[model samples]
Target: MKRIKNGIISLILILLIFVSGIPAYALEARPQITKPDLPFISAHRVIKAEPVYRVLADDKLHWYTTSADEFNYWTGLKGINNDGIAAYISPVPLPYTVPMWNMVKNNAEQYFVTSEESRDYVIGKYGYCDCGIMGYVVALNDAAHGNAQLYQWYRGATDYVYPALAELYGLDDNKWDADHYYNTVVASISSYKYEGPQFRVWSDASTLQEIDVLSPKGGETLTGGSKVNIRWKTMIPGGNISLYYTLNPSEGWSVIDEDLENTGSYEWTVPNSAASKAIVEARWSYEGIDANCYDQSDQYFSIKLGVGTPINWALAFKPLAMKALLAPAAPSNLTAISNLLQLKPMLYWQDNSTNETGFVIERKSTGSYEKLAQVAADQTKYTDSSAEAGMTYSYRVKAVNNQLSSGYSNEVSKPVFKKPEIVIPQSEPGKAGQVNMVFTLDQRDYSVNGVTKTMDVSPVSLEGRTMLPIRFAADPIGAETVWNGTDRKVTVKLDKTTIELWIGAGIALVNGVSTPIDSENPAVNPIIMNDRTMLPMRFVAENLGCTVEWLPASKQINVNYPH
Candidate 1:
């Protein structure tokens, strides 16, 4: 009886193993699995496969051995009906799919996957069992390989993957409760895409090297309607190039030409609109990517109105013709005068032409010409107060306009004159007021009280007495001297004193008292020379309350006036 019972236990264990190998639906009724109407899933029909496990709406997990037909039925039903029950293989792991579903539901309203083809491609590449985790892996691989098309497709599908899965699972929130899974997937893709240098080439046209504008740089004054050569340099060849202009750098870009080749230069006729602030932009493109290489002017330039004959608007299609303007004529009749009174040099010129902005006066020293001063257009004279006495200076003047300068005028040169030095001795107190007068020999130009006077006869020394014309010498000292032709005598009058003297006389009368002209030497007397009365300067000056001295080495005579 014991042997028979053991044989039955063994037989029962064999039957249990056989039942577990068969399809679960063949033995008992199974719960139906439903699908959700998500674009990522609906566009890509899940392939039928033998189910290895099952997930229920209530979070119940089950393992099953089912045929391909039963799995297909569940997959098709689950794709369209959100019954919250899914049957999938063990290859489609639940750990990743649950979290991915949660992410999609939270972000469904804000993000979307628009490309149906991309959804099918991703589903075909990575099985639809855990579609969310499959998409994440495909996106990372595409980004790492710099596959721009595939990367964009996967990025778009991200929005729909998790939310659609959450609907299929019949859960308001994600089963895995992952809050930032979507963002983490997106950030990882972006980081991996930018890791390689070639990523920019596939992703962004702006990241390509830019073209450089080589000519018509900022601040250039270009003539309107004139042909100008616009130049640029770029690494991208055999690409489409275009030119654009704007009055303001911020906006208003007008196309100059769009069918240009990237051959570095293009000839363009300037427009009629005169713009003081003009900017130009150059664009280069390869294939269909515009702005592949782009550059613009560093700053604003200027466009001036054209001159001369007007261009035909129909045939030429250019702005008004611009003629080059000439500068103002060179200033003429340039003259320099040495001012004896002010001890400076004055420069004068004639403005022979109009439209002159100013005149540039240059002075030539020993070697080179240096800019002296700038004067207004109407001004014709300049006073150089810094001129040094006894130095020669040459000067020239040029007329200037807004754009150019005329040739220099005829140069004029002159030497400045030096003035003589004078000295006066202080007088002592309690003594008769006396002054001394001295004059340099052969120096006819002299100034007294700021007025220049020329003497009829220069001063001379006669028998050791310095002599000068009585009228010329006495007038400066407030003494009046008169000549009598009939009497051949002269009279000198001062304050409370008078002097009378005849030509060729050794003696003279002072205050009606007869006294020798020179008490020390009788031979020294007053005479007439050069048709003027000559007198002993010392005697005459002393009689007029003055004193005198002679300097032989310098041929100068000293004069002192009493205080």
Candidate 2:
């Protein structure tokens, strides 16, 4: 009879809920929030010296005497999803800690203080009759104590979760009834603002790693040459800070003020140029850790020359047609094969222009010029099979695009040698201590002692000279290469000779004597391409007593050293 009566009571409760037209799922418990949405905790002050209390799973404000007890309550109650609470992972494991002082204005309002500047600002800005630090909460998080993060939330306030909750609760401008627990009465669902895990406190003292940007938060327009006060909240103390701004990331950052004292605010003069996209950044690096604690403007800002004035941009600056202003550069290092290995001699030249439609090849036999053939852009080698065997031919190439054409390259003359005069060197057997390396132009793969290897950057031709990366080209021949970044110079030591050349310098020092890197073309200098340093192969090989030969048929360079 007793069990039957208890079942009847439970059935009446369910019948009552259904009669009220309430959803069944509303009776379920709230789900757990495992991870925090924001990186760090945020601070909110409706008014100032009210002590912010940590609301535990019991739905009560608990202020512990010891930080260890506070941490114990936090970790113990963290897993319990009774209240909407979670922990955040800081970028740096051990963060700086400071004391949070509870300051009171009068017998009426209270203000909590973390920074001294903020403490003074409220005192001066707002009338505070009784201004004094009540007590300092330890905010240090280190290895000695168990690292625990402190979180803060506002009661009867809305910001992050305000919009969604306001609509659901039918809250107006002056109506906020949600408590710290934020639980529902009829339904089991609750909506509360997600104030980020505010303070990083693991030590006996209370402190935080939170730096908030205060002013120019986002979407603000200022006139050029106007003074604006940039403000931020600095939690970490005793370290220098740097301020920077940029139109865009691709344009790189420009320093506003570097290594300035952390004073929390700086007055800046807006730039004179007009820009639609501009951003500001505040970076702080503390001692004892390799971490950059920083923050950026929440949104991009705009800067105009004047307010409501339509300035003529055409009168301010002139524009030029890029294609018409610059023509394609002339091709260099023109070469034509002499030996009669095929039907016609082969012509090759280094392509010096990046923008070109095609190359126009001109041949002069006995008289003026005659059009030979036109090859596509980036083509370095061409076959002139139409040349008469007995007659000598002169070839020149010019790079041409739709809009402009480059000047003709250096003239190269090659006579079709008779078949009888052609000679091929006999293949000799390999020997120890003898090095033979072959590298093809515009190719990354090269062969050393019959073994193939790859290079980061390929060997290239510049100004009628074969250029190779000093390290790759010299290492195979038992040469030592060293780069001096300060002087922008490269040093190669082989046998008893030492060769040194500076980047963009025409002269190279050989055995304490200065000589032009390319005597034929004194303007030829070492250049950096694709982050690799390219040097004249012939100059280095000849100076090191190695035989250097260029084979046009395959566009290969052979460097041989005999021991």
Candidate 3:
């Protein structure tokens, strides 16, 4: 209902005060000079407490200014015709939890408790309080919760919102009107918490100093195949800070390119691979002010690029120039081909800077640089044939012209690793010591499936195999194993936890605990030979949620994972 207490306090106060005392004060034997202090006292006494109008402060608090008021204090809490009800902000020197958990649960903060009727005015239909009664905003951590007054319930009068939440045990008044006092709190700690802190981004270096980046945390390094999160930490907590980024001297930086709100941090990435020089800049562009990350003085402020970044300078392009980069009849696609995997890095740019001589793709683990592939002088494309199966590799592509190179392209970091292989050994139908296993694997490398025990560990060489329990080879397949021999359960931690497979006797157990594996799980019945246990890979892979692709032409089995 758009609470107007804080919004219209001046109007209400003006209407209530009388001018009779003003004229008499000045004529008080010329003693009216004390008018400034006298009127202030009378004003505060009106509310039975000291009340000071917010004013401008030079420091961060912005102390008494309306800008501060609009942003912090809720209009719903301006002034309530001397309801004789008030709330104060004071630290209760006791168990922190005692006060925090209790008062907050009641939508109450610190020392003042709102009447049931008052509660309805805060959250119920058309309820708004005088700004003066409500304490100054302290802090807001989420769009749902922050120090800003903008996020204070939007003064909603929804029947469900105020009633259901207020109905929780402890309101004391069965007829309590949660709708009236929902906004009674300067800061309410509702159960539905805003998970991450509010992020602030700015282009001005000065403001940037005030912000803290939570993601891509300082001193934290991400090689290939890692998530790039950009978060902002600020003194003034609020909901949804927009993030911004850019590279290139000509195209000055901006606050946020993405439209998300109250995001303290965002997912940032540079071509999956590390780069020698790439700006992974972050800015909170949500509000009108870009709280941090702008260098107004400099035309182009390149973010401090770290070492070992795989960069392709030739393909870098500014967002506004995307249209121009595309209009020039140039194909922007890189086709990489690999037996097991193919990873292609994309690049872009707005205008033609110099002689586009393609780009250089570098790997950090080893400072080896490769001309992986290239595009036309005006073209923007690169193909990478080095994606190793089961192994992760990082990649980034930038554009380059004869004169100078553009800032490195945005990062495209992902790791490429080779998949592992598993095989089963076959034993001579009637022979105990004579067993053989030759695995035709799709991937090149893998690890032992589980901790030993299911299979006896003695292989003459990597060639011969015996009857070993599946548990011994479970790890490579990404399976978690727990068995005391009787109640055997294999857990594939990839997606879910299970306890329903008893090898000897088919059975299932609840998750988190152990159960028996089923006999049907194994293709072949246990044939004790060479003093080892052996089972089929198909059964294990399927139960573990792994994708098994069998190639009839080459008799190859590929076991992949979501597991």
Candidate 4:
């Protein structure tokens, strides 16, 4: 029975072998499979360090790669790129890019295949078709992102045609076989092999961190000024686009720019911190990556996460530092003046800690702020004595570092007040220490838009028994003043404009035209008590087209143009 059972099992095994037929051994162990000792062939590449083939018969190029794993790394002759651009070894060497032929001149080696494999293709195995096809590739380049370099193999007057190539938009020159022409590079691989240890890689994850808000970026620092600065840095390979910002760098920085979805970087403010504090960062996610880091080429620092090392800033922000953006055009840095001085309300700003030139001393009137001055490359300080009395004026100073400025300084102002009390000893005859003379008053109502009233408060005459004479200041003619000269007539010439007055020879000459003196020309008397020329007050003012101002408390007079 045991022998019969064993016989049955053996018979089953034989039957199975016959039914399955000899199992085909298509695959071998990793080490057992013999690698084909094929000669290695390589060419200047647009994508992967791939294998490019020269049709041993006709040298026209086609997509060629030994393995599909490196497909993403390929772009040119081996890519089948939608752009149809490829690169080839140039036949003529170049010291630099000879754009005359629209070819990218990289300093790589060159070689050639048999004429039978290329230019001689039509009749020969490799002829015109191969040459033409290769020639077409020589002129192709990556227009997608403008990176891949394509090269054509040609030796003729064939013109190059660029597609959507803005950089080469004006490539018109084509020198035939000259040193200036961009010659197509080509060389057939005399030897070939399968390169082992091929490497295709992905990046490590990255991140950016939000740092701290800084102090005055060096300009005005007014309006709660630009004293508070924004700060941020990288943290992860993939960050939230919602983490970017522009105006407000301090408050909730999560709300990023809407355009962040459409663009790679967001706009941000820079303080004129002399580049010491000026920095901007971009944040985004790179999904599914390894062996990498996130950094901005235009910033001052960077952080590498792959290594457990605390970023020393040497490599973190090294290759990508934009130090120029930190020096901003000054905006709000200024000095507010609460104390008004008599000489002129001179504004003096705090010297810039950054010590920069090209400053602007802007002033705000009342509560309204506008560009008061646009002084460029200016040093500090400005005099503002032109302000009216009793008017509460506000002012602030600002400094500019490079093009960046700080916010306005705190506003400083004071009400310029004028006195109104008057003590007049009656205008009677025969008074002590009195002399008759012409007078004019300078009283203005700024609250009502600088409206002023002028009247003759004088009995200026030598025939009087001595009355008080009002006081006035040094002024040009055309105002109310007394002129008591012994001469019978007075002569005067108006300023350089279109006016001239001569009150001599018993006639008044106005602009070379003779006319009688108007009664209003001398509204006051002419009294010569002291050894001075005293005459009617209104004659001097009205003759020169001036407005009068009088202060009652001080009994002072002033004359001015219609400013």
Candidate topping lDDT: 2
**Model number with the top TM-score:** 2
The candidate with the higher TM-score, 1 or 4, is 1
Report the lDDT tens digits of candidate 2 across residue range 382-447: 988788876888999998888778888889887775432211122334676777888999998888
Model 2 residue runs over 4 Å out of place are 1-429
Tens-digit per-residue lDDT, 1-563, candidate 1: 99999999999999999988998678887778898533211011111111222222222211122234543454454333222212222111111111111012121211112234543332222111111211111123334321232111121111123323345545543322111111111235432222222110022211223477776777799987789999988743466677776654333455678648778999988875567667667766433224224677766678877865544332333221111133455765576655323358777775654567899999865999999899898788898777788788999999887766877888988676454333222332323544334477767754443345565347766677776776666765667777664344679898988988755456788898888887787667565443235677777777877666667898876666564
lDDT per residue as tens, model 3, 266-286:
665443333322233333322
Q: Candidates sorted by TM-score, descending order?
A: 2, 1, 3, 4
Measured against the true structure, the TM-scores of the candidates, in listed sequence, are: 0.24, 0.26, 0.22, 0.21
Question: Where in model 3 is the C-alpha error above 4 Å?
Answer: 1-367, 374-386, 390-397, 406-415, 425-563
CA lDDT, candidate 2, residue 431: 76
The local distance difference test score of each candidate is: 0.52, 0.59, 0.32, 0.30
